[model samples]
Target: MSLRTSFAAHRRTRARLREERAFERLLARAPTVESAHELRALATRR
Candidate 1:
């Protein structure tokens, strides 16, 4: 594999990890059952 390809892969992995952490934080403070359901739907779409 090329260096550029590896770097791109690493960047994508980091972004996905960041998004997952943000989503977890959202779940933690979701507020209401309806919102939690909405989160679930969003999660499934991902």
Candidate 2:
């Protein structure tokens, strides 16, 4: 692949990883079953 495409792919991977970590943090701190379900729904929506 071209260097530019490789860089773009890397950026996309980084963004996804960051999002997953943030989601995990939110899941860990979820206050109730309802909120957890909401989080899951939002994640699925993405």
Candidate 3:
């Protein structure tokens, strides 16, 4: 595969993992407005 394709695949995988981890963390935390906002911000930064 070309370098571009490899990079794209890597990015997609990393993003998926990050999303899953973030969801798990969010769930572990209480369902508060502050936690929700923090999750949103963390996702946006990624």
Candidate 4:
């Protein structure tokens, strides 16, 4: 692959990891059923 393509792939991977971490944090902090459901929907969308 070209350098540009490789860089783009790496960026996407990093973004995915960030999203997973954010989701985990949200689950940890979610104290209500509504918030947990919202977080689950958001994660499923991605």
State which candidate has the highest TM-score: 2
Q: lDDT values of the candidates?
A: 0.93, 0.94, 0.84, 0.91
Residue-level lDDT of model 3, residues 5-37, one tens digit each, is 999999999999997897878757857878878
Q: Could you tell me how far off, in angstroms, the CA of residue 45 lies in candidate 2 after the best superposition?
A: 1.3
Instruction: For candidate 4, report its TM-score.
Output: 0.71
Question: What TM-score would each prediction reach against the true structure?
Answer: 0.80, 0.83, 0.61, 0.71
Which has the higher TM-score value, candidate number 1 or candidate number 2? 2
lDDT of 4 by residue, 1-46 (tens): 9999999999999998998898889898999989999989877887
Best by lDDT: 2
Q: Give a tens-digit lDDT track for model 1, residues 1-46.
A: 8999999999999999999899889988999979988998989996
Residue-level error in angstroms, candidate 3, position 20:
0.4
Task: Tell me the tens digit of each residue's lDDT in model 2 across 1-46.
Answer: 9999999999999999999999999988999989998999988987
Q: What ordering of candidates by TM-score runs from best to worst?
A: 2, 1, 4, 3
In model 2, where is the ten-residue run with the lowest total lDDT? 37-46
RMSD of each: 1.4, 1.1, 4.0, 2.0
Which lDDT value does model 4 have at 18? 96
- For every model shown, the clashing-pair count is 0, 0, 0, 0
- TM-score of candidate 1 on Cα atoms, chains taken together: 0.80
**Inter-residue clash pairs, candidate 2:** none
Two-way TM-score contest, 2 vs 3, winner: 2
